[model samples]
Target: MTDWTPDIVAARFAEAAETARRLPPAKVQGYFNVWPTLLRMAPEQKPNDDERHFPPTPAAVERMLEAMRWMQMLDVDSRHIVWMRADHFEWSQIAKRAGSTVRTVQRRRNMALSQLTENLNEMRVVAASCK
Candidate 1:
C-alpha cells in the first residue's frame, strides 16, 4: 500500500467522521454497550514535555482523530471478538444477551476481529507516512 500524505489522512478522517455522524444514537450507544471492558483499556495521556520535538500539527491531530475512529469501529465490533476468544468463558451469556447462539457468536466475532485488524493495519500505513 502507498503511504498516505497528511492531507490524505485528514480526508480519510473526515470521511470516517461523516460515517460515524450518520449512525443512529441507539446504534452508537449499543456499540458502546457492547464493549465496556475495552473502554477500560484506554491509555492515559502522557505528560507534556517542553523539550519534546515534533509538536503536533493539524495533520497529526487529524491522524489522531482517524486513529480514534478506527478504535471506535473496533470497539463496536469487539463484542463478537470477545466471544470468539478461547479464554472467554462468558460466551454463552454474551450470546444470550445478543440473542445469538454461542457457535454463531464465536464465528461472527472472529470474523469481526479479523476485519478490524485488517482495517487497523491500513490505518497504520496511513499514519506511518505522516512522519
Candidate 2:
C-alpha cells in the first residue's frame, strides 16, 4: 500500500535486478518456480573465490524479496524486459537476448511498467479505503 511513486518503482526495480543477479543461477532460470512466490529465490550459495568480495546485507535481502513479489505478479515478457533494463542492458541487447525486436522489447517494458503502476494504484486505493 505504499505510494507507488516513480522513486519507489525505480528503487524496487534496482533491487529486483540485483536480486535476479544473485539468484544462484538456478532460480533465475525457469527450471524451478520456487513456490508461494519467488521471494525465497535469494542466493543461498556463497560467491566463488574468484567472484566479488562484498558481503550481503539483511536489508538488501529483504528488499530483493519484496521486489520479487511484485515481479512475480507481472507477465513473463514484461518482467524479463524490465529486469534486463534495470540491470543496465541496452534495448538492442535486451532485444537480442530475448529473441525479440528492439521495438517489441521496448513495448513490453512500457506495458510492464504501466501494469505495475495500475496494480500498485489499485492496492493503494484499497489500502486507503480500509484505513
Candidate 3:
C-alpha cells in the first residue's frame, strides 16, 4: 500500500468540504449527523445484513456518496483529513478551545495546507510531463 501523506489527507478533506458546502442546508446537516451512525455501525456485519442498518438520513447518504466519489478523484485519504479540513473545525477557535495560542493553530493550519497544495501541484506537473 502507498503511504498517505498530509497533502493527500488535506486534499481529500478540502474536496469533501467543498462538496458539502455546495449541497443544501438540510443535506449538510444530514451529512454531519450521519457521521455518528457511520462511526458506530458497520454495513456488512448484521444478522439480517439489512441496508437499513445505515442510519444516516437520505441527504446524509447522498452527501457521503458524493464525497466518496470526490475523494477518489483527488487521490486523497478521506479518513485522515477530516480534522484538518475546515468543516470539522474553526481554525482560529481551535487554539482557544485547546487553551493554546492562535499562532500555533495558524502554523499547523498553514503547514497542512501547504503540504496538500505542494503534493497536488507536484502530481499535476508529473502528469503534464508524462503527457
Highest-lDDT candidate = 2
Where does candidate 3 stray beyond 4 Å?
A: 1-15, 21-85, 88-92, 96-99
| Each prediction's RMSD to truth | 15.0, 9.3, 13.7
lDDT of each residue in 27-125, candidate 3, tens digit only: 544346433544325655566444333333666557556545434434233223334444666655566554567676666555655655566567767
Model 2: C-alpha RMSD to truth?
9.3
Query: Which is better, 2 or 3, measured by TM-score?
Result: 2
User: Against the hidden reference, what TM-scores do the models get?
Assistant: 0.38, 0.66, 0.38
How many backbone clashes are present in model 1? 1
Q: Model 1 compared with the native: what TM-score?
A: 0.38
How far in Å is the alpha carbon of 13 misplaced in model 3?
6.1
Q: Write the residue-wise lDDT of candidate 2 on 35-117 in tens digits.
A: 54222223654455434333346687788777778888797877888888888889899999889799988887777777787
Sort the predicted structures by lDDT, highest score first: 2, 3, 1
Q: Once superposed on the true structure, which residue ranges of model 1 sit more than 4 Å away at CA? A: 1-71, 74-89
Candidate 3: lDDT over CA atoms? Answer: 0.53
Cα deviation of 15 in candidate 3 (Å)?
Answer: 7.2
